[model samples]
Target: MTAPDLTRRLVAELVGTALLVTVVVGSGIAAQRLSPDDVGLQLLQNSTATVLGLTVLILLFGPVSGAHFNPVVSAADWLLGRRTRSGLSGAEVASYAAAQLVGGVLGAVLANVMFEVEVTRLATTERTGLPLWLGEVVATAGLVALIFALARTGRGALAAPAVGAYIGAAYWFTSSTSFANPAVTVGRVFSDSFAGIAPGSVAGFVLAQVVGGLVGVALVRYLHPEVGEAAGDVVVPHPETRSPS
Candidate 1:
């Protein structure tokens, strides 16, 4: 766990985010083609694929990058670890966010190429509204709180399936279909498909998600004040051990 190891961790984050976006965008495109007239069926198919794909990705990459494909998740991890020896440095957090953003965009591009679609088109699916924003806050808050809660309770092992299942359920329960990850949100902007979000809507969703992330952190503070024996552990190797800073 040194500078070279940090690079590997960042690569894992990048690759994991990229693969996740591929699953999301690819499945959405497939759902659109398979159920042209059935919106509900399209959603069903998309959500199912995302759930299974996400679970596998987390299990596959968690040990490498903590499987934090989401920017908010990385921030949360850093914040939670600030007082501990395992916390991520500011530089590492920045690296993770950058890698995830780049990865997400690449994933969208790969998905588009595989599906024979325009490679860099912007999404036009308008998802603007207070209700949807509220849904985003709720979805994101629940996600952040759930992840930290699990770690706080020494249940990191349950993260793969639990996190995946929560996202699949949130897709149905939330108005905006739970575009909870900022990197994922940015990635979806590159595709005009069932899972895509218009550029105009991205800011609002990102803002709501940020607010939700803050709320989630507060929730974790109140709900699990003391970090368990495994409190500082992440899905991947602890950042303090790998980061050069």
Candidate 2:
């Protein structure tokens, strides 16, 4: 795609990520209020909503932006396709990251306003330590692997339900509750809700996620060595672009 196409894609990423963060933070807040006495119930409610919301978002916006919604995914795409003619450009990667980050913060603020909470309140949910960081690594690695694997195997159409389900499962299986998206991680910092992560821990989580993405890239290379061509979109299936690669 050309620069103009990239701009449109960036806009889609921004809007999709904004709505994603809203759903995550909003659902977490609602869960906290509804299940005040039950942590498990709160988690169940939050995860269910996230799964459904994410599925819808991907389906709705994948055609426009590939529905990356995650900085790591964009980074992975750029890194893997750096040598390819049709790969994402450095400028596109930068745009995607910036949009996702800003959208995440905006989404959190919107959620706060919708729920009558203080806007831009820093999160105090202390998520730290080796085990949780390890969980982040595992969660992020799996997510990256899943997306690339689907594309590599010509099953991109399954990204919506498959990724959503994987994330929902990761919420329970991973100790960190699967805050797999870096943009989402950063966004969560603006809300001291159930989905929020403390600002102090953001650096560690982001680092772990970066490492996880590298691990995922290695896995995709080892498992799908033949994935050289532009297998449709980077993260999810989108309407085929007729523009020159």
Candidate 3:
């Protein structure tokens, strides 16, 4: 099957990214007032919101943009060789990633203003600790890997719930509480809300997320060689990577 138009796909990605960021930050505000000590409750609340929000967003835009709201997922798409010579152009990838990045920043700003949040620790400034940072890297890796591994089924519409479920379940299993999304991570920087990341810690989190993306791609490439037909055709429009077929 042919890929959707590149422009539309990028737009879809940005839109999806925006929505997911909103949920991540928005929920934090709601939870802070609900219960301060119950991290588990906050997680359940956040993950449930994400699973539902993601399901709707994907169902709404997956056909148009492939719903890759996270940069890591986009990176994985190229790494797995999913794009074709005719898939999204290099310009499209760059533009799409840029859009996602800006959209994420915007989402964070909005969350801060909307919820009256104040970010205390931005990125590496906070001592979430090396262990926490590493955990986030691995948690995010599993999330994206699941997408790369599963998206090829071509039935991702129905498969979205599985996506939501895995993410929701991963909440309790891992220490990082499953950040799994770069856009969401960036967006969290704006809020001093419960789930928000410290600004100082952002660098470590992003790096870990990127590494996790690669790890997920490599594992899936080896584990699911039959993922998508467009694995190695290299006619990439993006200078950095190839499109997924």
Candidate 4:
């Protein structure tokens, strides 16, 4: 299959990340407004919207960019496929991360504006401590492990719903509400709402996520040693421009 142009793939990543953050932040705001007294109910509403929105976004963008709205996923793809030269090149990985980060920030701003909140306000929600950090680790590790497992086992077709389901479940199971993606974590810093994360906690969460991603890659290598070729299809198989090695 012919690969998509690099520009097009970047656009897909940017737009997909943007929409994903929009869903998360927007839903959080809506949930807050609708369930002013019940935190659990607000979380339920937010998670449900996120699950649905994420599934649709993946299905929509998977054909174009594999719908990897997470930087860790992109980095994992590169690390796993480096020896086989089947996944993204270093330059491509860098570009993908940049686009995702920018998209995440833009998405947050868009969500804030849509909700009539101040666009530049930083989040004040103080999410810190060992439990939260550990939660981030577990959440990110599981997410990476799941995505790669699906790719390795020829289950990429189920990624949309499967991934969305995992995130929804993690939201409740994890302590930090499962801020698994770094881009999304950073984006949340821009919104001081129910979904937001304070700037002080970003570093810890991001570090834990990175560690979790490495652990996830290790697990994939141990469990599916022979399926490295499928690394290019992480999240979902999409047209990819393999850079010159």
lDDT tens string, model 4, 78-181? 99988888788989999999999999999999999999989978999999999999999999999999999999999988999999999999999999889899
* Order by TM-score, highest first: 4, 2, 1, 3
Q: Lowest-lDDT window of 10 residues in candidate 2?
A: 236-245
Q: What TM-score number comes out for model 4? A: 0.98
Off by over 4 Å in 1: 1-4, 228-231, 236-245
Listed in order, each prediction's TM-score against the native is 0.94, 0.94, 0.82, 0.98
Better of 1 and 3 by TM-score: 1
* Per-prediction tally of clashes: 1, 0, 27, 0
- Scored against the true structure, residue 38 in model 4 reaches a CA lDDT of 100
RMSD of candidate 1 to the truth, in angstroms, is: 2.1
Between candidates 3 and 4, the one scoring higher on TM-score is 4
Q: Which stretches of candidate 2 lie over 4 Å from their true place?
A: 1-4, 239-245
* Error at 169, model 4, angstroms: 0.3
Q: Residues 1-245, candidate 2, lDDT per residue (tens digit)?
A: 33337778888899999999999999999999999999999999999999999999999888788899999998887776665534466777788999999999999999999998788579999999988989999999999888888888888889999999999999999989999889999999999888888999999999989998989888987898755354346667665433345
Worst 10 residues of 3 by lDDT: 232-241
lDDT of each: 0.86, 0.86, 0.66, 0.92
Error of 2 at 73 (Å): 0.2
What's the candidate order when arranged by decreasing lDDT? 4, 1, 2, 3
Q: Give lDDT tens digits, candidate 3, residues 1-245.
A: 45555666667777778777787777766776787788768777887887788777766766566666777766666556534442344566577677787777666666666776664434332536777677777787787667755555444444467667877777677667777777777777766667677777777778888888778777776777765443322111112223334
Looking at model 2, residue 121 earns an lDDT score of: 76
